[model samples]
Target: MVLGRGNFSRSVAFRWIVSYAVILLIPVALSVIVYSQTREIVEYEIKRASVAMLKQVKYIVDGELRQTENLAAQLTVHPDVRHFLDLKAETGASAYHIYRTEQQLKKMLAANDFLKDIYIYSNALDSVLSGETYASARMFYEMKNQTGTFAYEDWRELMIADHAGQYVQLPVKNKEKKENTPSYIRSFPAQAGSGAAGTLLIPLNAEKIKTMLENIDWVKKGQVFIVDPNGQILFQNSENVEALSATYRKWIGRGTSTFTDTFQGKKSMITIESSDTSGWSYVSVFPVDVFWERARAVRTLNVLGLALCIGIGGLLIYYFARKNYDPVKELVNVFSLRQRQGTSRDLDEYTYIRRNVLETIRERDDMKNRHVRQLRVLQSYYLSRLMKGQTDRNVPLAEAAMTHHLSWTSDRFAVLLFYIDSDEGGTTDLPLSQFIVSNIVKDSVEGRHAIDFTDVDGTLGAVVNVAPGRADCWKDEIEDALAQAYEFITARYKLRFTTVGSDLQTGLDGVHQAFLQALEAQEYRMVLGEDALIWYGNVKPSEGSYFFTVNDEMILLNLLKADEFEKAKGMIDQIVQRAFQRQTPLEMAKCVLLDVATTLIKSIPGPEQAGVAWEEWRPLKRLLSCATKAEFHQELHDIFDKVCGVLRSRQTAHAGAGIGDQVAEFVKENYRDPNLSVSMIGDRFRLTPQYVSRLFREQIGQGLHDFISQTRVEAAKALLQTGASIDDTAARVGFASGHAFIRVFKKYVGITPGKYKALQ
Candidate 1:
């Protein structure tokens, strides 16, 4: 058994090592190449995503700042504030009209949610009103006494002296004098370039600025601090004020606008800049650790993928080395020409041949599967085009069938839809039951017709072609064939089944219409349970309207008012049913729903109390496009409730207009005029007759005619007291004649004009 050293050197083990080394090296090199390329791509993608997010955040911050500036500009232009400033400058009035100005400022501030407070600081009067109309003067006196001998005269002197130059610097002292603050003073320039000789100081809202910064989506959380131009810590997010103050001092005097620094040993990215308007520098510190934490997960995924590739490559080398050596052993046994033995060697050879044969078969199967998939795709594309009434000139029906590997030589065809209920849910993998059903349909109609099957939305459609003229006469036979197929599938495959057959028609053009009818018949599965065959022409037209009634409208309105959206949806469904029952077309019902919704929406008040106009409700149409029927109903209810609220507000305003009192005064003054009427009174007041009528009806519960006649008749009775003739009295109080006046008098006073005069 001893072999030479040279022969052993050329043995299978040596070759195996060479093969393993080559095989292993290939994947190692590939893994390194993949890792390097992937790392670069990941880094670039992260940087790109981060830059995009930062730009979005910057845009949001800039928008908010611009809004704040615009608001300030608006406040500066206020007429009341302007008048107060002017009055204070001319009269040096500390107390005069200060209460009125403060009240106006308070109301203005209260209207906006963003405003914390608004104050008018009068440089001339040397007084401050913190948007309060009625704070006691005694409190101000006490504050002045407590703040180290402060007085209005000292403040006035400071303002006048400050405005005498281009710029002024003064100490800002709080009312409690806990800390001294710096104030940069500048003269308020007049609108026409003429200088207004008054000092102005705007105290920045540090908290509000911090809030604006925090609202930025990309601003990293935790310990956000801002610094003013003079290196003061104006705001801090952290509760530990002392730590925040310490952190601010370390970077406050730094000349750089942006730089990275460490806070409590954690790396932070800080951005600092002076505001263009206030010259206040804002610093934002975002910790790098937070950013790195997000990157960690991505890094782990990349590393794991690389490691997996390397491990698989190593396993492949080990597998190849072990398997390749076994072939060498078999070769040695064959060369030796050993004595007769068991069939082990033969079995190994047979196994190898079988494996090779199976691999070849598998490759062929894969090719066939790919070909079938391509055919299905073409069929689906053509079917969609056919349904939409489009034709392809390049591919005729016969050529299309050939291209998709389908048989189309039959003279006539009928499309059959087979619905199978299986355990599999959703549009993922097709179920085995579907394949069985297809086979059953093929078997049942064997030799009688040629059939092609396709899957659509979890159901199988079989296009069966029979001889021309045979389909119409054999329609019952065609249905029986499909029914038998369906029953067999349900029993054999243990699956529920539904079959819908189209009318017997010829060619692909007929197939489209047949497919449509087949689909329509399938809808009957809702009423008739599975395992049944439905013919196209046998299906009836769906009865009833798809809309609700007036009672449903009331129910929906009440539900919406109470904010019960779920119950409102149920009622909307009922309404849809009732509408369908009333023969209301689907399109008309939808339009009615849209109108109800839009009317409700238009009734809502505008965001700024400007009141919503009909044009603003136009957006409701776009909202309607995406809304479901139930959702549309709820939206309509919401709009109506808002409109009702606006109406209530308007009604209250009208009632408070003193319409009843005004009408009484008007009637009293005009009662003796011959031509006086409600219409004349309405014209005098510049009001519509209908509006006046409504007012009278609501307030007095009487028509305008009744009120006018009562007043005129009473006036006639009073004139009679002066011993005037009935005709003269009637003529004086807006009556045409004694007889006409007598008729009205009797109607009202239960007596004729002369009788009323006799009673007097």
Candidate 2:
């Protein structure tokens, strides 16, 4: 009995030890679980809030950038700036003109302190005129000539290569000036042709950007970076902080909005927000320990409470453990239910933890998938902005490539615009045919390229990323792929396609230029005709002026004046044909057509006398509003036909030599009168002096005033040769004075009247 009691007492002691250990362990496990779970939740909230706040910062910064871009564009197209840029100085322009241009630039700069300085490099003047100084273009060139430090030539090449809108240069401090100001430069006439004028530099104050970033509370203890699209670091919060670490940069490059990674030798939460307007990214980084502080305090309290409960009472320890465990079990049950429904009764505590862990994994995967989808949408948005020349320069092309899941044959990119010409190719669905074609093209050229096809404006635009050392070889491959796609689409859906591909450009930086070239190539159909794959290189811009000259208009006027309606119509057709074929500037063509319309309106012989209200048919507004060349041609034809109709109706009212005959008759009849000039004759015929002069010249083979002088000199010569006195001859010839008569007589006869008389 004594041995059994001793064994029972030992067993009871062992059970009590085990029970006490379990009771003590519960609070610790609960504290750890609570701490871990709370840390995760807090970290998540911080990341979300940080990312949201960065997005707001992006919006504000993007607005500022857009405002800057607008200011640049506004200054570029400003009438005063353009006028100054277009002024050509043979040697040097007048001081007043230069001073006037300088004053205007000063006013523009004075209006905004945000702009450091606004300078216009005028190729015409061979000068760089700005608020600071009026200097030669060579001086401006030398100012940027830091050779190895900054490749001024490379930036110049980039600016010249781009003609889309504005070519942007990332900030770089000028070593010569000893100032750390980061300049934002924009080249005018964005898609600068060979006749590119110059660039406009707006060196921004770094402090302004720094102040803006400093005002944001999210990045108090953390770091923030303003990065360029090319992956260049524009501005950073901490100068001591090294370049972006590969681990953190990897997440950023992949375009992950919020990610956790080790940075600066500690775990950090990174949040990145990119601007659609400027193609810049705002990065905010905070240490992981920031959110863990609250959880750590709770952990410390739990540890002290457990230590206190150890000596206080076993009942107290049990109550505390049960209280903490209840919430833990409830939390576990919530996740466990999501993993496997209606199995809570059979599941142990370990099973609950496992189920919860598995559920979190599944949720993470779902979130990843959604993030991937969002990334693709962002990629599309990025490309569209590139096409529109609105891409932010703060995001690296490599990062873009990662985010967009792009793989290219070469670094060079070319934009191909595929236009669907069929009216009923894809049933009632407008995008069906485009979708079919895009897919086929993508599938056909798989592995050799990276391409994205989306509707740009109304046409299907395909941006093809290709690697081409020799353009001809690449053209063949591109043509083969395009031909295959065209043939397949045409055979399958009976849809016709006209594809225009731009020249290969260096990188994504040139996408806008490539897109613009593709658009320009599309216009070549006006010259090259339709149904061919038009390459931008093949459609070399036809150089020289496309403006309608005096000779061209005079030929048309002659045909109209002769009542040759058919010929006049043919002439109109020829003029428009030349304009279309030459690919004349739309504005220039509109202006030429307007000129033709005005000429036609003026050609109507006495519209007032013919009872025709010609002013009612004011075609200037309609001509000015024309958006397309076709519309211009149609408007031109309408004006021509209307004007010709009016002329045909009034043909009998004013026949051959109508106004010319009357003007010449009046000039001859009143040639002796000293004041009988073209203006006097014009007054008699109710015609403009300019028109009277032109009419008299066409009919009489000399100007009316010249004929009058010739007649006066002829009369004086006859009087002088016939032994008439110089004074009598001068008076009879209607000379205002004797000296005036001698000057005119000597000019025509190569001798004074007195000298001529002595010779006779």
Candidate 3:
């Protein structure tokens, strides 16, 4: 059991798995924390949104109430009304003088939308005047009977009494529509302790206030209420108003504007917007499940998203960890001395691996020169493959590393690369020359770092294990050693060799990465001069490569298809120029240029439709062969020029044959849209408005706007003949109002819509 436990605990694979599982829990914990913190924010936003909407209702209703109160005060002290109530009128009220007061009342009633009717009482005359005419108490009561209750057996007693009370809502009918009208009463003779000269009564149109509430910006499923200053519910939309009325009254001025409370066994969110002018409150109550469901949905989505991420992230972590663990597993299988020579179980995994690798190295060094040469060839080929992938599978790094006596226990590694840049004419192809160069490089840096050598494509690569406790200044030390090797090789052999180095990286996989960066930096030799040493990572720190994105691909294709070849080519020019100016390696530059070339080829419609010949095969292969930046840019431009010609023809073909008919058909189908004008059609077909209008006129034998107007008016004729009202017909045909519809209908049909409908 102790031996088994030691093997398990020392496993690198086990640690990786534990680390992967631990990493996946980060997002899970973050999702929980984010959901808890954001729920309160969501509820506050809901309250703030509700309050903002209700405030508009409050403003409109409050303004109406204040204006009505002011109007009532004005009517009370009016000259005609005061003359009728004068105590010095010895012969009592004159009929003609009272006629003016009745006319004023009628005008006020007609102007105000909220007033259903108005009544004025005079104690001196012992008569009540109303909006219409002088009427007896029986006649006035019958006209406004349902609106309010009057406790007057005689007019003098009724006029001198104060009728301060809540507003009353009564049903008022007009044709088939029945709406409620609420009544408000105010006393005149504005004295503290004096007899009331009369009373002014106004029956407010509650339907108008409800209409104001209905115009609230955001519609929430809720009950709306209008409460007066006295806490009386003037109007409510709930079916069980009596049940919720006490709750509404209790929650008012509860020191908080919005809160959740249960009413009639259902929890509700109450939002209150109080009016400043009249002290009236605009209140909305909605079921929590109905109104704030978005908050709950957010929390639910967060949980589901967290679960989904854990599932996906767990699989991804395991796949990567298992894949990365291949090297260690292969190493144990290949060179486990404990398994091969039956060593003691007391030896742990690392100690067993180190002993096996050291014994193998001893055996390799004892081999003959022929065997050594063959081994070098195999190591060179396999290590060269590492230049292409992070971990090359051609030869397992574990076996190659053990056989080559490469460092197996180091924490950091980097690359030192050198190449014969003076052979720009491609003259040198000597195998012995690369062999000599590799030996000199390995000899110079061998003592300072553990080194392994690989030679491919005439470039010598040295993989170095950074010395322990030397990670911070490893770059400077390695570069200094490489500088000495470059000088010795060039001065002695007249070979202008440029050196490249990579930043120190971690793990066995990092050796592969170090090889890749060295190769990428090799491409920048001609751009930065043949003698310059380059670091791929430090090319441009502040500005990253300006590579083409998905949006750029779409824009380039759109411009090409529209025959905006000038703009498309300009975009390509910008992409290439900006990427080069940013001083990145040719990898990003190649990818960006290849993408632009592909999009340009895709923009060419087709062979038969393009009326020309073009080939998409081997296009990118040609791009990759360009040796220098100038040659690469020129090749991409050549492709652009060819595709541009095909696109111009495509654009011309679309404009020449049936474009007019297409525009005319589109207008006929969408003439009901008020925004369907020349510019909209031009944008749809990628033509100027003038060009589209002229083509439409030539094909359809009418101006574009005139045809649209005629089509709408023709449709209006059918609706009008069906007894649909003029305004409804106008709106149905997309006219802003009946007036614009009538004007256009007359211009097209040689008569107004009304006249045309009558004739139809």
Q: Which residue window of length 10 is worst by lDDT in model 1?
A: 164-173
Residue 680 in candidate 2 has what lDDT? 77
Model 3 residue 257 lDDT score: 87
Error of 2 at 128 (Å): 1.9
- Give per-residue lDDT, candidate 1, residue 332: 51
Clashing pairs in 3: none
Model 1 error, position 299 (Å): 5.0
lDDT of 2 by residue, 455-493 (tens): 788788877877545444766877888888888787778
Clashes of each: 15, 14, 0
TM-score of 2: 0.34
The root-mean-square deviation over C-alpha atoms between each candidate and the true structure, in angstroms, is: 23.4, 30.9, 26.3
What TM-score does structure 1 among the candidates reach?
0.31
